[model samples]
Target: MLDPKLMDEPARIAALDRYDVLDTPREPGFDRITNLVRSILGVPISAISLLDRDRQWFKSLNGLDASETPRDIAFCDYTIRQRAPMIVTDAHADARFCDNPYVIGDPNIRSYAGIPLETPDGYNIGSLCAIDIVPRQFDPGQIAILQNLAALVVEQLELRRIAERDHLTGALTRRAFLGEMNRAIALFERHQRPASLLLFDIDHFKQINDNHGHPAGDQVIRGIARLCTGLQRPSDSLGRLGGEEFGILLPETGQEDAARAAQRFCETIAATEIPGTPPLRVTVSFGVAELRSDWPTCESWLAVADMALYEAKRSGRNRVAIARHDASHAT
Candidate 1:
């Protein structure tokens, strides 16, 4: 059992957020590890489970039909609270799990073995677990194998974190941003959840570079990224789409709210002086587009947003333009 006094919940969640793996589509890299775990351990179920705020989301699940379970009812929840591997030889005989729903009902988990997927910074973000339907004891050799596999899972997560972020602004790279947009699209398709995109770029950015030099432009970009990152919610994603251009994906947000956010961003950036040799003030134009049921792909959605951005630039910059649902133009 984990001691309540030993846990720093907020810091742990922040560490997990740095990975940016939540709500992402399953990848072959993770799926392969889960598959290997099931095969090597001879378990009916093996999963790479990440503990979100209220749920234990499966990054990869082998032999499981469900994608997630309530955190309170998850066996992996306990695994993440301690450094050592958590093993239950018989769930029915254990006081902690005898009344668990998964133990008594579906899956009938009789045995379990899990290793904590600890980040390099020492936060236990989740677990890699091997589950069995029949009571069994895992030998020392088997535990060692599971531990090694869990390390591989953490390594993959670290690699993804490095690959997805921009080197200068620490924002999501263009490719990773598009990937996140696709994931949001999938979520909206499945659950009809409202989401919106905001595309913006620094107004007269080339003039700033030419007048003040490229170093000044780089500082301005970093400043804008920091400002937007600070303003966004935990669920929102900020990305560096290209030179002087950035995109923000606001999950569960509508066009109206997103436009308001973009307006705020525009006003804030225009008012603040970015730190440099002489300091620089810059304005930005914004395009806001909500996810539409008719849009079939991420590219279509992005195109609409891009059109709206062009409208903002045409309408005198430092303003927000909302894309129409018809995909024709912005208002």
Candidate 2:
């Protein structure tokens, strides 16, 4: 029986969402493990199941089985709800199994054992289970090996999660951001659809550390990051390029749009009230530039924006400056 209280639907759904790995095609590494289990144990079926909202989705499976089954009839559902292995020696003999559709009808699972697949933090996401038409028993060694295999499944899932994330701001961290930027630039160059980059930096961030304290400065940096993130559009990318500097990649935006975004970033920082500190207002300067066809690469296009940023700092701090590549660099 499933524990109603412990099997939190919302938390489980949230965990599944974080993986960003639903409905993906099967990978060979996962398939190999399921095949090995079936071959070694001489079972009719073996699977690496992921418990989804209303179904048990098989990432990997061996033998005749469907890719998905209803959650109500899913053995993996009960498997994940428990911390330890769920073993049913004879489905017909057990009270819980006798009433199960899987036991009485199709598949007729007579012998079953499943080990929970858990994340590093101990959230049991699903299970690695083996099924046989005939009743059977597993030795201690087999159970241990199955548990170890489930751990490997989790390791693979974690690797995929880290690959898609940006290490700095906990946002989409792919070099692919530039790939999208390039496409946007191409459209702007062709149809004059308008695009811009708001390159900016923390004003006197170094002095903040020297005066207030490094910890306070770190808080300020984090505060700025939050502000920038809050000001972003779904289509916009806000990333920390390096220390004390950040880049906002905007699409379909002109000088006015870029200037507005820059102003919002600066104002957000100024209005924020830092804890345990006097009313200290922070400011940021901006360099806005439009995309150009002559700039064949992302680097060259960004160079124009960077130059505008340099001018903003040189003219005076806490100001926005626009750079047109057609014009000479801001002196």
Candidate 3:
């Protein structure tokens, strides 16, 4: 049995969450790593593993049939605990794993070598390992190669974070958000499926910073970003357009649906309480525009949405307004 203290659940889990890699679509970088491992080491199976709360999930697998299994039953779980690489040249002879279910059951591992995949901040999120059905010694040269490969995998994950995520808030950054909007536009053009854009900004944000301080204003921004993000479906993309402003791209959504979603965001933001903050609440204004062929490009569509947002601000804050494009094309 593994000692609970060996795994710092909170730090490790937080580190894992920061990458945002769990259950995401498989990428070429990881697949390439596992394939190289299998080829270079002459191993039957190789995988990049990530530890979630209870499961050891395979981010990449070559010659492995399973996607995930119990963390207690995973070799990578034990490997992640070690600062140095873990090698079990003969599983059946090792006291730590001799009677382990995996060794005695399916997969029937005989030898294994794992290099811990450490985050830049030094959290061991998981491991990159090669498995063999027959016992074999893992030389220092081979172990070094595994270490380098593990670093490459972590590098790829970090690159994804820089490209897709905003540092202050967990929302997508402006450029990345626009890329998502463009992709949605391409899909709409191909299939003529309904889609919409929602642009919004916090009301009286300067006042919050003046009265409560910039830190409180930052907390408020993060709170609202999470609020809008949590309300959307997986297909939707929410982004921090700029300070105190955010945009959402809703795929397969029409004008009415977009309006309702914007309303929910407005109401939710108004009613929610910011934890560990001073006695202050915030409100937001929203503008929605459904996809239209006449709008053509993503920028053009966003311009229309921005116009609607201007209208919302012109009338009053804390309300949802629809764009002329959506109103004209309402179906």
List model 1 lDDT by residue over 196-289, tens digit each.
Answer: 9999999999999899899999999999999999888988999999999999999999988999999999998999998988698999999999
lDDT of all predictions, in order shown? Answer: 0.92, 0.76, 0.87
Off by over 4 Å in 3: 1-7, 166-170, 173-237, 240-261, 264-331
Q: Candidate 1, after superposition: displacement of residue 244 in Å?
A: 1.6
Ranking by lDDT: 1, 3, 2
Q: What lDDT score goes with residue 217 in model 2? A: 77
Global fold similarity of model 3 (TM-score): 0.60
User: Candidate 3 on 1-331: residue-level lDDT in tens?
Assistant: 6545346779889889877666655678889999999999999999999999999999898997877889888898889887789999999999988998889987889999999998887788999999999999999999999999999999988997888888889799887787677767767877777889999999999999998899999989888877777788987888998899899988889999899999998998899987647845789999998888878777788888888988899998899999985543432
Error of 1 at 47 (Å): 0.6
What global local distance difference test value does model 3 have? 0.87
Candidate 1, TM-score vs. the true structure? 0.84
Better of 2 and 3 by TM-score: 3
| Error at 272, model 3, angstroms | 16
